[model samples]
Target chain A: MHTAGDVRVEDRDDPEIIEPTDAVIRLTATCVCGSDLWPYRGIEPADHTLMGHEYVGVVEEVGSEVRTVKAGDFVVGSFVISDNTCEICRSGYQSGCVHRAFVAGTIGTQAEKARIPYADGTLVATPGQPDEDLIPSLLAASDVLGTGWYGAVAAEAGPGKTVAVVGDGAVGLMAVLAAKQLGAERIIAMSRHPERQKLARYYGATDIIEERGDAGVAKIKELTGGLGAHSVVEAVGTRESTMQAIGATRPGGHMGFVGVNYDVHIPGFELFLAGIHMEGGPAPVRRFLPELIQLIWDRKIDPGKVFDLELPLEQAAEAYKAMDERRAIKALLRP
Target chain B: MHTAGDVRVEDRDDPEIIEPTDAVIRLTATCVCGSDLWPYRGIEPADHTLMGHEYVGVVEEVGSEVRTVKAGDFVVGSFVISDNTCEICRSGYQSGCVHRAFVAGTIGTQAEKARIPYADGTLVATPGQPDEDLIPSLLAASDVLGTGWYGAVAAEAGPGKTVAVVGDGAVGLMAVLAAKQLGAERIIAMSRHPERQKLARYYGATDIIEERGDAGVAKIKELTGGLGAHSVVEAVGTRESTMQAIGATRPGGHMGFVGVNYDVHIPGFELFLAGIHMEGGPAPVRRFLPELIQLIWDRKIDPGKVFDLELPLEQAAEAYKAMDERRAIKALLRP
Candidate 1:
């Protein structure tokens, strides 16, 4: 990212194995994220910042300590790089691991090649080289898919639960898929976008409510026997969406929020009065990589469908614009 | 409370059965609560408002529809009145029951006689009339002990977990006891008060840190190998205390806040980044009454020690003053 709304595909030296635990991978696919819009729209500062954290690639070189994957191995890595052996990682919060680093600004997965630190701990190699058709799905596993799954799991979505997902972006759609796979009996997708709503249903949303904010909360209550959903997923980090998600969850229910929070301030008294369980943050994608990869490999989930637009790496600017203008749920960039 | 700082025991007609589900109880014991200070301190509006919500008493009369407990039965009731049969109640969130009412503002338990609605669902009868020595303990079960237990449970304190209690008040002390009973491996009590710190140790706190806010959080992290406690209980409702509790919890850990939040506001970005589970509200004390009453009856837990001051009902003003001035952890009033 050169400046606000200025994305350039610039030439740079290929990433190399700089650390004993690092591995360099030739990119197969990478994509723009909703959070990227923060810098693209100038909400967050950008000065030639390396963008894109989601990636699926083939190992090109590995440091002596990178034992998990070898050259020619295809892998999916977490958006947040983590030493999976850390206490936090062992406790299933690799995103907050003692040795953690973000893959976005540092690695710029959208390039031809990138170095992944703590490669053994951050990358999970597929059982074998995946078919071409599975590339996008594998790329989605790098971030959005894993994040949505974490949201659903955090919300405790399961059989007999009524899951309500707030936000109709790629992550929200992925959460709908996760809720379905988690066996939630009912899934309600909150969205005003027709395309996203249609995709939500395909991903197993049993109901759709276009209303938002206070009205959104009321509609959820109206649908859930006046008790609200048993599990709510907040995929938009804005204050209104966060509150709506909380209000839509029944007292004693759970809410999992995964959107990158910007400036949302929650009134403690209101949250206390809501009497709900809440958990959120950057998703521990590394924790779910193995399962997510296997699911995609088996064609049990087609998360790749979330990528409605695809472009070559040279057209990265157009991809960012498409996502920012809501013209695409997500955009895949082939190097 | 009659205006801020003015509490008087005034003469009034004894409460009668106003609802078919009503039961009149002759109070055995009642006590002042921290929340009462809100109105007493003029932070919240007050105008001759009836106070007190914790009580242990003998059933004096039962209306036509009242079941469960008849006249002459000794019982303990939750601070929140709930129709335990409601879906919310059935889901273990009795405080959010469809027909729930706050016992504080409506029917003041700190009286000679009081009418309780939803007798069958709100009050739990003891196995038998308790010995005179058990009165205070039974009264504690009405709110403090129950609320603390809920906090511990909500924080998921259990065998393998290191629990931290933020706040040196009665509820915080009770949470120490709860955490112990729940088998937490370690318990850290954050307090600057010597008396409360000693009480916390007695309640099974393994360590005491005479620090608060950021320093307290740092001490907790230092004690837990720089990972923070696995479970945290927030018994103080202030913004500083809430943030301290959240900060003291490890990534993927749990925090249960039972403090009656006043004007606290939590930054969403911070909470999200913390990657912890949070659950709180007016505790669903009714859900744990059976187990708590049994624990008290079996002499397994003596929660009555939280009350350091005792006075007659006519001395309610002095009791309130003692609590407001921090002269007493809690004050028990004999009606």
Candidate 2:
């Protein structure tokens, strides 16, 4: 598939394993991310880029250095993977590794093949070749699901914490799911869409606040004893959404923002006086892929339910459009 | 005393106790602050403000609730006297208390007689009435000095740490002093001014870099083997200074900003990716006042040397002009 304004179903040359450390996989299932909507919205840098990142695939070839996998292994990998031994990777921030490489557009996961770099460190083999029924959920583990999990962890969401998730997009909704899985006692999901509200509730949101801005802050304060939530996940990157996340957190709280930030500016005075700890970038999805993949393999959670629409890999453009136009919570593309 | 474009010495009626919770203090000495120069620069609100907030004075009277000090005790008090038992105050953020009040304009320490409110919680008595010689050092502990100490503490500067200070103003210099006193192994003072460079070296700056922006970032990386410092103190609030402080810190480092941020903006993406813990606002100078006072009394450190000029209260305008024009690091006004 070639990426146009949306990804196209056009034929392209088949990918081949080019390096000793590389792996070629036949994508079993792949999905577009809310971040991909950025390019569709004309905010992100896009130039002949393949559109999707999340994928679960069957390995068709393996490099000699990749001793961990064989041709038929089913696997899920993080978007960016490293040796897991470099200084940055060792520090648990694999996203910033000296040799970091992205998996989606460069390798084109929303196609019949993907060339995964640093296979030993990035790809996690499932317990066995999964059934077709598990494909969507396993694909979720590849990016959206794992990204959200990292977002929750970055926000410090854990037992007894009250987490407020800003944005009703798939990542934000999945963050609600992740926070719930992390044992947060109260999850306040901010969303206006009725369908998303339903999904948010299903994902364990204890409350829903439709308001935004100052009014939203007031409502959150009212619900949270005027102290705001202990943790907030900002899955939308905009001045307004960033402020809402900051305003919804109490003093000494933490905000984990996974949104691809574009021109978002936080006022210095408010941030200084608010006293909240902030940490998040592009999710180190590689760090959490193994555990999340395990969770999905064991059937302990059903994250695949987030994919409301599925299209053949040939219709990748429609997949992007479905998610961008809000006609679908998430779109799964089958190759 | 009158405060104009410049500080002026003038006559006024002796301030009467405004409330039963107030005390009258006969100031021994008062000094200028970088913050005070803000209004004179036409950046801050000007209203013939009473001018000074830093002082070492003899208590001439006490409120009925003031059990900590008696009428003849020499004391140091916070810029804002807050009742320590309030919910917000007890949280160790007394400066943001519901009833917080500042002393500079309403009860000017730059005057002969200064009115102190919430005296019991605000004033800390010295070992005894200090000698005339130790007055300036003690007065410095009242604001700028104490603020620097708090900044260091907020930055978590301590043993085996490398601390980077992002401003070369009085507070920044004093922060170097505070960080050194707290046992930081390396202190990188970001300065190029000869006067500040001398003071920074004297106060234990292990290194100095004059570059700003990306060049400055490169210098810091070069200094730290590309890992950046463990702690950073931001004493200047502009976007550039804030970014410098944040950017100079390592992944898990802390950034303590005590600068009065006026209309400054920070990019969310950079901050999130940095993963630096940040804390600071109006310094809770009160929290550090007692310990800083004791350190001053013990003569362990003399932060007061930052005052580079002295003038009688009558030439307050000249003092303000001296500081505003950068002729002095700080000025002292003896009323």
Candidate 3:
């Protein structure tokens, strides 16, 4: 992003193995993320910023210390880089790893190649070269699929649970799939977009709530016999969306918030009175990578369906515009 | 409490069973709570309001439908009344019960006689009351002990975890005891008071930090290998205390905030970055009543040591003043 709203695709030096623990991969697929819009819409600063984080590729080169992936191996990497050996990473919070770094704005993956540090920890190789048709799903596993899976797991969505998702974005849609896969008894998708609503249903959303805010909370309670959902996932970081998610959760319920929060402020008194379990923040995508890759490889989940618009790497600007204008749930970029 | 800093003891009609499930109890013991200070200090409204929510007493009378406790039975009751049969109550959130009522503002237990509704759900009868030495311990179970236990449970404090208590008051001290009983490997108490520090240690706090706010958080991190505590209990209902508790918790750790929040606003960005599990509210004391009563009866835990000042019901004003001035950790009243 040269400047807010002016994303120009420019030629730059390719990423290289700068560290002994690093591995450079030739990009096969990359995509725009909901968070990318923060800088695009000028909500956050952007000046000559590297654009993408999500990526899937075949390893082209590995530093001497890299052992997990080798040249010619197809691999998927998390948006956040982690050593995965630190105490935090061992506790399944790889995003908060002591030696963690954001892949965005540093080693932008929306290019021919990118360098991934901590190769043994951040990158997970597929069983073998993935079939051509499975590329998109594998790419989805790089971030969205893993993030949504984390959100579901954090919300404790399982058998006998009524899970309510509080966004219509790609991440929210992915959470629906995760909840379904996790065996939730009911999945309520809060969305007004017809296309997203359709995808939500395809992902196993048992109910659709077009209403939002207080009305949305009331609807959830009405649907859940006046008790609200047992688990709620907040995939939108806005104040309204966050509060709505909290309000839609029953007492003693759990809420998993995965949206990148900006200026939201939660009133402690209301939260206390709501009496719900809340866990959120940056999703530790690396924690669920192995399992998500297996699920996608097994053809059990099609998270790539969230990408409604596909464009070549050169058309990255258009992909940003499409997502910013809400014309696409997510836009996949092919290099 | 009649206006701020004014507590008066006056004669009034003795409480009578008003509901079929109601039971009238002759108070044996009651106490001043930290929350009571909110009204006493005029932070919350209080005009000729009844006080005292914590109590242990003998059942004096029971309505036709009351079955759990009969007249002459010694019992401990929660600060919140619940029908117990409601879904919320059955789910162990009796404090958020569909038919819940506060025991503080109405049916003040500090009086000689008080009416308790939903007796079957709210009151736990002791095993043949006789030991006067165990009265105070049993009374603590009415609220503080149970609230602290719930806080510990909410924080998931158990073996191999380091638990931190963010207050030195009765509830905070009880949380220390609860964490110890739950098998937390380490318990850190944040307090500057020598007396409270001693009590915290006696209750099993393995470490003490006199620093507060950011300093206290830094000290906690220093003690836990720069990672902060695994489980944190916030028993002080202030913005600084709340943030301190959140800050003193490691990423992916759990924070149980049992403090009755008043104007606290939690920044979403900070909390999201903290990446921790947080659960709190009015504790479901009724849920832990049976076990706590059993513990007290068996002399396994002496939670009553929290009451450092004792007074007769006639000196309720002095008790409130002592607590307001921080001259007493807790004030126990013999009604």
Candidate 4:
């Protein structure tokens, strides 16, 4: 991003293996993220920030210490680079690793070639070069899918549990799929858009509620026999969305929020009297990559359906605009 | 509390068994809570509100349907009345039960006689009428001790866990005892007062930090090999204390707050990256009463050591003043 609402694509020097554990990937695919819009709309300050984090590509070069994948290997990497050996990494919070790096600005994937740090901990190698048909699905595992999965896990969405999705974006819809895969008995998708609502149903939503805020919470409670859902996935960071998510959770239930938070203040008194559990953060995609890759590889799930628009690398601005204008749930960029 | 900052001892009609599940108890002991200070200091609004909740006394009468404790039985009651049969109560969150009732204004325990609702669910029968020596301890089990235990439980405090207590008042001190009883390997008490610090040590605190806020968090991190404690008990509701508690918890660690929150607002972006589990609210004391009573009966733990002052019913006003002035950790009233 060159500036607010401005996107410019230009040729740059190709990345080279700089660290003993580094790998340079020739990008096959990359995409626009909801968070990218934050800087695009100038809600977040930036100066020509190199954007993009989600990626699926073929390894072009590897440092001497790299062992997991070599040249020609197909790989999917998490948005955050982490040294898996760190204590926080080993504790299932790799996203908060002491030596973590965001792929958004420093080593963005939108370029033709990008250097990936902590290759072994950040990249998931495919069995072999996957079919072109599987590219989008594998790419989804890079961030959005893992983030949704993390929300479900954080919310403890599983057997006999009723899960509620608080957003209808790609991540929120993916949460429905994650909850279903995790064995939730009921999945309520909150969406007002017909297309998104239809897609939510296709993703395994057992119920749909278009109401928002207090009414949305009331609907959730009414649907759950006045007890509310056992787990709620908050994929929207707005104040209304978070409040609804918290209100929809039953006492002793959990709320797993994954939207980049924006000025959310949890009223202490309400949370105290509610008796609920809450845990959230950037998803530790590295922790779930193996399982997600296996599932996508086995064709057990198709998370790539989230990408509703596709564009060449040169049309990156259109891709961002497509997502920004709600013309696409997600935009897939080909290099 | 007739109004903020004022305490009055007024005569009133005796409480009678009004519900089929009710029981009347003649109070042997009642006390002021740290939370009471909120309204006493005018931070919280009160209009001639009857103010005490903690109590231990002999059952004076029982309604026709009462079965858990009969007349002449020594009993300990939770501050919140819960119908144990409710799903929420059965789920161990009696404090959030649909049929729950706060005992502060309706049937305050500060009087010579008080009515206990949901007798079978809210009141735990003691092994037998205890000697005068056990009254104070049993009384503590009604709220502060239970609140501390809830904090420990919510924080998942257990064997091999390093737990940090963020206050030095009755609840915080009891958290040390609770964590010790729960098998915490290391219990760090945050307190500057020598008397409270000594008592904290007696309650199984393995370490004590006199510093507070950021410095206190730094000290905790230093003590825990730069990783912070595995679990944190937040017994102070101020923003600084809550922030300290959150800061002192390791990544993916748990923080259970039981402090009566007063306008505490947790920042979103920070918690979103910290990956900490936070759960707090009005404690479901009724859920712990039975086990706590059993532990007390077997002489396994003495939670009552929190009471440092004793006064007659006529000195109720003075008891409140003593506690308000920090002249006593707690005041046990003999009615």
Candidate 5:
């Protein structure tokens, strides 16, 4: 990753065990994340920063202190690297651990090899190596799937609840999947694009609203008998998306937003009078990794359908472009 | 209430039961609220709007559908009138009931006689008509104390939590009391006023932060060993207060705010990145009125100390002016 709109497939020195708890991994699969496009679009500063925080990899080497996994073990990881034992981590917020680190901004994962710090806490050893067919789904669990899962959890989605999702990005579609898995009685997906709307239904969206802004909010209200959804997932960080999500939630409802906010501004007058609960940030995906991995391994859930394009690691730029242009919902790169 | 910066206590037609669920109450005591100052400060349009919502009163007359209280019943009421039987009311958010109404901007309680809509849901029958001394405390429950209680509850204050209260006004001070009552292990009050600071400590504040803005946040972080408080109550609605509350709370922590927001803009980037749980708005005071009234009747809590000045109802204008000028923490009016 270089300046805005510039990405290159260049060779670099291979990663090796750097920290006492670090584990070097040989990449098996990685995918472009919706958040990565922020820097790629110049919405954020990239300027040659290490990019990509999602990966499914095979452990190639382990530091002396690494005990959770050994070489040859395939692992699923979260975007945030945490020690997993801090008070914050213990309380299920590994994303805000005392010693947390962002792998995307520090050590890029879209490479042949990457180093995972706090390996035991950040990476989950899969039940042996996964089947090739299941690897993509497992990779999805590393970030997008985990983030979507956290969004549902934060929104308190569960049985008998009506969950509404804003945005049609990969995370939003996966949130539909998560809300379904969480037993939401009904899930509403707000999207206009035909393919994304279809995926939303496949992921268990009971209804899809094609309108945007206030019209979309009115649609949600119309569906919920004018009371609004009980739980709303905001997967878009724009001002309109945030407001729409808040507006679509019932007065005493909960909203969980996981979008990487860029220029969004939420007026306190609206937020205060909205009379809803909200919790969001970089999701503590690590906190939900074990359960998500087990579900994937047991064939209880399939979340990797998001990968609409597949390419070799050498074709990473094209993969990024495909996702950027919305030609593909998501692109999976195999090394 | 007249226009901004003006209030009157002129004679008006006596309120009679106007709705099936209405009850005419002869207020025993009424008080001005921090929020009343919003319109008083010209931030809100208050022309010809009924003013006060906090009161303790005797039921002078009850409509046929008013079954909860009788003509002689003494009641403690919430600021927001709700129908109690609505799905939202049944869900413990009477303030958000489909038929909810604000006592202010519709019908004022500062008058000698006022009509309360949705009597069963809006008013809690006190164990019995109380002594004069308990009137002020009971009046506090109508809004300030209840709002504070809801703030504490929304912030999830509980055992082992370090709770912080922002602002030193009546609501903020009551939040200290609420946090203490909710079993928060540590309560920090952020205030610069010496008298309010003393009251805060007396009300169970374990720490007092006299600094404002970032310095206050630094003090809180320093006090919490750099992890920030587990719960924060924002009683000031300005941008600084909101940010301070957000900053004082640890990631994964909860914050409840009840300030009447004025010109406050929250950048979504900061809110999303804060990684904290937040619930605010017009507090569901009706939900907690019964318990609070019981506590007040039992003499277990003394929220009435907030009333630093007491005067006759004829001095309503003076009372409003005193509170607006910060000459009094709160003012009690006798009809």
Candidate 6:
């Protein structure tokens, strides 16, 4: 699956259990993430990076220590594997684990099979076997969807809170969906696209503001009694989005950001004077995987709608191009 | 007394009770603040600006609605003139009141008399007349000391937490003192001066890290199992100090900053990646004045000891010169 560009996908030997805590998963579905766009854009340090972190699959083999799921079980795993007992993971932040390692490093889901370390702690088992209908959504629960949900959680979105989502990308759109699930009374989607606006409203955005900068701030304030939104989820990684997130929040509100910030600068005085609580980074997908997987199994929500284009694993190049060209909200690669 | 410099002491009409809610205070002692130094140095707006905001004084008269203190009562007040009954003020953040006003807009404390508005809400009185010896320490509680104390509170400094303080100014020094009184298990003072180091120790600093940036981060990590402090107080308004405070904290930790941000730039990516909770702005000195006054009256702490020099109001220029020249940490002017 090598493209005319960099990063050739070559055939590799099937993954084996490297540790008693590891399990081997036969990939069924994996998708390209907006964060994955970082490397292709020349922002993230790509090098020989395997280039994918979201996946849903069937367990092919399990080591003795893997008790939560057995062979033939359907599952989804987080991007960064961690031992759940560590202080970092125990505190519900698995991405910052002391022994943290990204899935791309060893046998990523973009391939035929992958080895999941700390399998019991990092992977969530679906109820029995997941139907083909739920596969894509469960795969999304592995990273993007869960991350958007975590962003809403970090922003403290809930009833009576007005939430402003600062990006129209997949994650940002999903954040609107998450805020709605969290019972946000009013959701403002900051986007100009007709398609995104439609999706935003369908996902529970009560209002839409396409303005940028001071005008965008003014629009949000006009809709919020001039106090700004109670919560802001920033899903675009840039100085402007960061400032917009801060400026869109009220005096004692919160800003949750999960954008893969690649060289963004903020003015110190503005942040200091804004007085907003900020908390975000790589999302703790593992922390939400179990619940998300359960929700998907129960058919409670359909977050998989974010993937607008689907391609075979061999056509990964076309998938990336579709997303890179902005022709797709998100692209899926079926392995 | 107008000097050859920016600092001037002019004999103005004695402040009288103008509003039914106002009170007149005869200055017992008034001191310069680090923030006040900003205007004196022309870094902030100062032309026609009345000089001080911190003072411990004898109440000369009280308006009809003033019930908290009476004539001849020794009292301390916050820089914010807020009606305590407002929703914002009742939330313990008087500085953010809907109708908030600052002492700087009217008559300041570097005078023989000062007019205090919202007297019942802004002023806190001692049980009885204060001893002359307690005046200096009590006066410090008016702003610098209270601001620093609020910095610690905002940082959530309490039992079993390791706290780091960024800045060695009078406010920072008092923050070190505040953290100690708040029961922080470990206090790391980020200072390089021998004098400040000694004062920090006296204020209960358990350790000192003189290095800065990555090296300082490494030092803090080495001291806390490579996890950073649980709480950090930022009292310097520069970009470096703000970053240091954020960097010096562990994931899920908190940073409380009070330094009036000058020209500082913050990188949004780094802050987002750090995942620390931050909330700060002008300190609500009115909320803490009562307890601080009691502490002063009981002689448990000596925050006013931060003022290293004293001068008659006639020598206001020399006082400013001394502070601007770094010859004095803080200067007290006898009106």
| Candidate of highest DockQ | 1
lDDT of 3 by residue, B1-335 (tens): 88988899999997877889999999999999999999998888999998989999999999999988999999999999989998888999999888889999987887888999999999999989749989889989999999999999999999999999999999999999999999999999999999999999999999999999999999999999999899999999999999999999998999999999888999998999899999999999999999998888888999989998999999999999999999999999998
lDDT by residue for model 4 (B189-308), tens:
999999999999999999999999999999999998887888999998988898899999988889999998878887877778777898888899988998998888888999888999
Q: How do the residues B96-119 of candidate 1 rate in per-residue lDDT, one tens digit apiece?
A: 888889999888887988899999
Give model 2's TM-score versus the native structure.
Answer: 0.89
Runs of candidate 6 with Cα error greater than 4 angstroms are: A1-14, A62-70, A104-108, B1-5, B11-24, B39-49, B59-73, B81-91, B101-107, B116-121, B297-300
Candidate 5 residue runs with Cα over 4 Å from true position: none
Against the true structure, what is each candidate's TM-score? 0.98, 0.89, 0.98, 0.98, 0.98, 0.90
Regions of candidate 3 where Cα sits further than 4 Å from its true position: none
User: After aligning candidate 5 to the native by TM-score, how far in Å is the CA of A222 from where it should be?
Assistant: 1.6
Give the distance in Å from residue B27's predicted Cα in candidate 1 to where it truly belongs. 1.0
* Model 1 residue pairs with clashes: none
Compare candidates 3 and 4 on lDDT and give the better one: 3
Sorted into a CAPRI-style docking class, model 1 comes out as high
For candidate 2, what is the DockQ?
A: 0.45
RMSD of each: 1.2, 3.3, 1.2, 1.3, 1.2, 3.3
Report the C-alpha lDDT of model 2 over A102-144, residue by residue, as the tens digit: 7656776777888888788778899998878788888887877
Clashes of each: 0, 2, 0, 1, 0, 0
Better of 2 and 4 by lDDT: 4
Which of the CAPRI classes, incorrect, acceptable, medium or high, describes model 2? acceptable
Each model: TM-score of chain B? 0.99, 0.95, 0.99, 0.98, 0.98, 0.95
Candidate 5, residue B84: how far the Cα is off, in Å: 0.9
The better-scoring model by DockQ among 3 and 4 is 3
